[model samples]
Target: MDEPKIKNMEEFAAVSGISRPTISKYFNDPDSVRKSTRRKIEAALDRFDYRPNMYAMNQNRRLTKNIGVVVPYLADPFFAEIARIIENHVLSAGYRPVLLGSHGDPDLEIDNLENLRLIKPAGVLLAPLGRVSDAERLAAFCADVPTVLFDANIEDLGAAFVGSDNDQSIGLIVEYLCRTGAPPAFFEIRNPVNPNANKRRAAYIKSIEALGHKPHLLQADGEGWEFEQIGFSEGTRIIQEHDLPTDTILCSNDRLAIGLLSAAYQAGLRVGLGDGCALRVAGHDDHPFSRYTCPTLTTVSQDYAAIAQKSAETLFALIDSSKHFDSREETLFNGRLVMRGSA
Candidate 1:
C-alpha cells in the first residue's frame, strides 16, 4: 500500500479535474453540483483523506462551517439544555458550533457578537438579553451575519425567531389552575428580562378578565437570570406578610416557581390538589429541574426540541442560500400541558 498524495481541495481538484470553486461548492452542498460531478468527487474522497482546514477554508472563501450560538446565560439549565439540542443538530448538519454566553451582561453580549464576526461564521443563533441588548448593534450584526433568534427575540433584528407560544402556554396554565381551584395570581418579575414574560403577563390578564375573574398580578422584584432568588425572596415576603387574593399561583417560568415552592415550604404552606393543601402552584417552560422539586411542578412545557431544530435548520438554509430572502420568519411552538403534583 502507498500513502495517498492528495493534501487539500486544490490538490484533489487538480487530480480529479474539477475546479476548486466547484469542489468548495460541493463541500458546501453536495446537491448543488451535477450528479456526474458529485460522483467524481465521491470517488476522490474514497481514494484519499485530504480535507480542508476549517480555519483556512474560511480564510480562503467568504463562508465556512463555523456557526456562532450566543445566549444570554448558559448557566441556566433551560438555556443550557436548548443549546445542547441546537449544538447536536448543527454538528450533524456538518457545521461547527461555537457556544458563547452573554452572562446576562449587555456589554459582554455586544463583545461576543464582535468576536463572532471576526470568525466570519456562516450564521449565528442568538438568544439575546431582551430590552437590555443593544438593538442597534444587534441589527448591524445581523446585517453582516445571518442570525436566528431563539429564547428571547427582538422584532426585525434577526433573520428569524423560534420561541415558545407565550399566549398559549400561559393561558393554558392559568385556565387549568382556575378550573381546579380559585383563579390564580400571575407571579413574575416586575421588569422581565425576556420578551416572553411581557406576552405572558398580557395573556394572563386577558385570560383572567375573559373568564370573569380579576387577576391578582404579583410583581416579584428581581434582576438578571437569577429567577429563583427573586421568586424566593418575593414569594417569602408575599407569603408571610401579605394576604394572597387567590389560592393558586401561576409563575411565568418554572425557575421562579421553584423559588416560590421553597418560600411556601418555609411558610408552612401546603401546595397540591390534595386535602388540606392551601395553594395550587403552576409554572411555564417546564424547566429540566422542575421534576426534581420537592412536590414536583405542574407547568406548561415548551417544545424545546422543535424550537432548537427549526432554528438551526432555518439558519442553515440562510447560510446555504447565501442570500437574504424577504419576509421575516417567526415560529412560535405551542407548549404542552404537563400535569404534575404541584398544581
Candidate 2:
C-alpha cells in the first residue's frame, strides 16, 4: 500500500516518525540537529516531497524573524545600493528583509510601516523622508517596534541613527575646492526634500567663512526628488544669466551637479580644472553616475558599506535585546573627497 501524503509540517512529522519540535528545529537550522537526525529528515523530505511554509511557521512564533528596510526613495542608486547591502546582512543573520520604498510620499511611508507592523517584524531600518515625515506616527511605531534610522535623520527619534557626517564631508570638499581653485558657490534647491541638503548648506557656509571667503548661495526654485531636472533647468538659467559669483561651483549633491554639467555642455561652457576651462564643478555624494560624466565629477564619497553594516548590526542588537536603549544612539561616518577631472 502507498504511504499517506503529508499536507503540513505536523503531518510530515507524523509520517517521518519524528517529534514536531525536532522537525521544527531541523527546519530552522539543519546544522543544529545531529548528523543522523539531519540525514533522516532529508530522507523523509525526499520521500514525501514535503517542504515547510516558513512564513506560516513564523506566524505561530511570538516574534517573526523579519527585518523591515524602508527608504524614502529606492529609485535613487545610493539608497538602492545601501538597501541591497542591508538585505544581505539580514539574510546572513537568518532573518527575512522586507524592503519598501516611500517614493518621496509621506502617506506611502506610513502605509509601509503599517504593513510591516502587521507581519510583526523583529525590527526596522528606515531612511525616512526627513522634514516631511510624520514624526508622531514614527514615534508610535518606534515605541512598539525597534527601528534604526539611516541616511536622513529626524532629531530625537528611532533607537539609533547611522549615516554620513555632512559637516565633515562638506568641510572637506570646501577646503579642497578653495585650495585647488576659486571658492565654490553652493548650488542647491531652495526647498530641499532631504534634511541632509540643509546640513550640507550650513557646513559649506561655515567652511567658507572660516576660510575667509564670502559664501555665495545659489538657491534653485524647485521641489520633489527630480534633482536632475531641477539642476538642469536652474543651471541653464543661472548660466545664461551669468549669475555665478565664482568660477568654481560646488553642488549640494551629485544629481544637481549632473544637471549643471549637462547645462554647461549645452551652453558651450568648458568645465574642468584644465586651462581654458570656463568653470570648475564639484558635488557631494559620489553618485554612481558621477564618474561616468564627461569630465568625471569630483565629489565626496559616502561610506555606503560602513553605514549599511552599522545600521543592520544596530537593529539586530535592538531586536535581540527586545527593548529600546537607555538613550538613543547615532553613528555618523565621515566622507572622503574624490578628485577627478570635473573640479
| Candidate that would win on lDDT | 2
In Å, residue 260's CA in model 2 sits off its true spot by: 1.2
| Candidate 1 Cα RMSD (Å) | 3.8
The residue-by-residue lDDT of candidate 1 on 1-343, one tens digit each, is 9646786788888878889989989987888999999999898777776676666667766777899999889999999999999999999998899999999999999999999877789999999999888999999999999999998879998889999888888778778877888899899999998888999999999988888999888998878989999999999999987658888999988999999999999999999888989988899998999999989999999998999999999999988888875878999998999999998
Model 1 TM-score relative to the real fold: 0.86
* Residue-level lDDT tens digits of model 2 in 1-343: 6667778998998889999999999877788999999999999999988988877787777788889999989999988998999999999998889999999999999999999887888899999998888999999998899999999989888999999999999999999999998999999999898999999999999999999999999999998888999999999999999999999999999999999999999999999987789999999989999999989999999999999999999999998897899899999999999999999
Worst 10 residues of 2 by lDDT: 1-10
Please report how far candidate 1 places residue 186 from its true position, in Å: 0.5
C-alpha lDDT of all candidate models, in order = 0.89, 0.93
Query: Candidate 2, overall lDDT?
Result: 0.93
Which candidate leads in TM-score? 2
